[model samples]
Target: MNTDAALAALAALAHPTRLEAFRLLVQHEPEGLSTGQLVAASGLTQSTFSTHLAVLAKAGMVKSEKRGRQFIQRAEIDALKGLMLFLAKDCCQGRAELCEPLLAELACC
Candidate 1:
């Protein structure tokens, strides 16, 4: 991802509730979770959780699909990978050696 996009993604994740929501969504993986489920898990009002979801969607970190009368939210793993690559490139610069350890640790994940 470009710097601007990376910044947006990072900023979107910086919020406590948003970060929690994203992590919860990641754990659900390909199946995703309905908007109602997320609201229940978050213990937040539907409108409040929706605002958080919108921020994540705007940052390209989350995607939603309409399923019947509800929406299912999923984390955009590719966008996350892109953000990681952007940060890694910035940190390593011309020095590939500096990135090796981080890459190795990430591989474990």
Candidate 2:
């Protein structure tokens, strides 16, 4: 992701509801979850959650597919990876040692 996209993704995740929604979607993985399921999990109204989903979608952190009559939302893991790489690149610039520990910790997760 470029700086703009990284910024957008960071901004989108900065909110509690959006962050929770993205994490929930990530847990679901490739199967994803329907819009109704997401709203129910969020304990928010459909309209309210839709707005949050839109932000995530706009940031490329969430992807939606039309499944039957509803939409299935999936977390864009690649986008997250790109953001992490972007941040790590700056921190590990000409210093691979600094990033080794961080990479090791992330591997556990």
Best by TM-score: 2
lDDT digits (tens) for residues 49-101 of candidate 1 = 99999999999999999989989999999998898778777788789898889
lDDT of 2 at 95: 90
Model 1: clashing residue pairs? none
Poorest 10 consecutive residues by lDDT, candidate 2? 84-93
lDDT of 1: 0.93
Residue 107, model 1: lDDT of 88
Q: For each candidate in the order shown, give its overall lDDT on alpha carbons.
A: 0.93, 0.94
RMSD of each: 1.3, 1.0
Model 1 segments more than 4 A misplaced: none
**Candidate 2 regions with alpha-carbon error over 4 angstroms:** none
